[model samples]
Target: MNKPNKAPNNKEFPLTRETWRYIKRRQKELDDAFLSKAKWLPNDNARLSALLIERGELINEFPETFKWWKHKADDRARIIDEYIDLLHFLAGMDGMPAALFTMDGGYSRIMFEAETDKWRRLSNDYVLEQLLDYSPNREYPVQSACKVVALATHIMGRLGFTDGDILVAYDAKNAENFKRIAEGY
Candidate 1:
């Protein structure tokens, strides 16, 4: 069977529902196969904390003005890295199905606003934990997991991330992680 090509970027938004679903599915599969395989409470807590921290770092990338002397890391790449890390934690949860997330507007508002975004990220972590806590004790914490995935996708959009950037960055990071693992790092 042949599949038709997708239309190019929307210029305004970087994601599509189908693409978002695919990325989430891919992340879930990879996490299930690797990161979540030997789950631990400490690791879960680390993921949650890392996500909150990433959100904070991501905000820093947008400075009020750029200094000619201040050579900084690529902000876009940094955001993507943090975003993927957050996805990894969400993936580790292993709860949510891909269908729960999409590129549309139903997210909990994570725009360019600093104050609101910070608070939102905090609230999100709280909600994620609550979801996992209420879920039945099992290998996959489905309830909290899916909600997190949905929220993360929304965050991607709010952070001005694109589907192309995610696809590329994710592959690169995944490959690097594998290589590092193979090298016993």
Candidate 2:
């Protein structure tokens, strides 16, 4: 469990291969349960659309990330929740490699570094290009999905969340999702 008073520290819950594996496995379980309840087949296009929408929602949580004049205080808890919400959709996408989360000096760097608004804008634009303009025929869905995850992870880091923090939030959200399904949500 995450201690709310503690500062974000990637070293506390390092991104080991086992930890990445557990996250992937748990996400798959949640996806299976969600799909089973809805009786809906997975569609790549729809998932892509949903991922894009969730990305927008996550972006909405950080007005300070964009609006230079607005000096609102950071809402760490809400930001973490929205990040996990984005992860829920990301897990459903096919071919997202564990290396993106586990590898050294690659995607993991983006997840650990503090992002400036310029870099964030560039990353967001890159994701939009990959998802919207680059792959109309969906020929490279995995690549596009990878970019989306990269952007999401970068944003999470920007919000000062560690990989371990994400796992805790994901666990909590997964249970909430299960409960929602049980209640016919």
Candidate 3:
């Protein structure tokens, strides 16, 4: 008997509901594995706090979701708070998964903001000892606040803007355009 080798038609080989369910389960497993292995969080709070404070506000300030908190009250605030709690715990070396999981949007933002400020306040020398913070010079680190501010200014320089350039935009799109240009570099 000669067996014909042919591609299975979609209609002839319909995926069973259970097959979809199994596929979903495998997908979830893979996602979980990737997330678990991700280096999204620094090994310790001090470093984590520095990264968060330096970049946390930018996360919410993205054009797609910028100022979303101004409209949504309860849900956003709660999430931001939760994120704050996580940052606090993490910064203090007391982080737990449950605390992070319980955070709502608002709390998440709050935490992100707090971590940013905390890192902003620490001294350059303290960072070397307390947070193991690094500097290109190794022997001397510039003020963390100054470094962050300069980064913001340089980013603006990329889009034909300068440290003193003033932009006035009336609409979200315009504002976003300016922000994009400023941030593009």
Candidate 4:
């Protein structure tokens, strides 16, 4: 139940340990890839802008009866149509699991059992008390709570908790490794 009016304050959502660790891991991977690449492509920002503009126009002209138009109609017409137009391409939408937070529609499948339980156990009063305690600075608590929810979900899912529904499936070799470690004397 986040306030829909404003984006949460960044200070209130300062990165948690798991979130920071994930960011570091991603940075290391990016550095490794950059060092390994034998060739680099020149920046294509201008071409991308032109393409975006062209697609934006086409998307606006799409039949108003199009399926996606209904969901996005409340937003600025041009921006919503422009984004949906971009989603029309495979390269634009594929292979991006991490950038899903740009819009609510992008969440793949949110299994909220764990999230709901966490919130229930933590209690709204406790959260509000924390917000009040920090209120001298007027910091909102919603952002940090959201980040905690996300990181808890990721860490629990990664560790094979959360009913295994959100967990990534493992291959046979990894399954055997799990058994060996779990059964250690």
What's the CA error at residue 124 for candidate 4, in Å?
20
Q: Candidate 2, clashing residue pairs?
A: none
| lDDT per residue (tens digit) for residues 1-185 in model 1 | 11223536542334455554455566655555454435443344445455455544544443322233566654766667766665555544434243233322222232212223343544434433432333322342333333444444444555556667666676677667666656655
Model 1: weakest 10-residue lDDT segment is 103-112
Question: Which candidate achieves the best TM-score against the true structure?
Answer: 2
TM-score-better candidate, 1 vs 4: 1
Q: Give the RMSD in angstroms, all C-alphas superposed, for model 2.
A: 6.6
- lDDT by residue (35-99, candidate 4, tens digit) is 35425431223223333453435334323323354544422334323322232221122223333
Count of steric clashes across candidates, in order: 1, 0, 19, 0
TM-score of 4: 0.19
TM-score, predicted candidate 2 vs. hidden true structure: 0.67
lDDT of each: 0.47, 0.57, 0.31, 0.30
Clashing residue pairs found in predicted model 4? none
Tell me the alpha-carbon RMSD of every candidate: 8.8, 6.6, 21.5, 18.4
Q: What lDDT would candidate 3 get against the real structure?
A: 0.31
Arrange candidates by TM-score, descending: 2, 1, 3, 4
Model 3 ranges with Cα > 4 A deviation = 1-54, 62-142, 166-185
Better of 1 and 3 by TM-score: 1
> What is the RMSD, in Å, between candidate 1 and the native fold over all Cα?
8.8
Tens-digit lDDT track of model 2 for 1-185: 22233334543223333444555667777777787867667676677667767666666666565445778965778777876776666556634432223222332443335323324556543533332333323554444554566655655554456767877887888889889878888
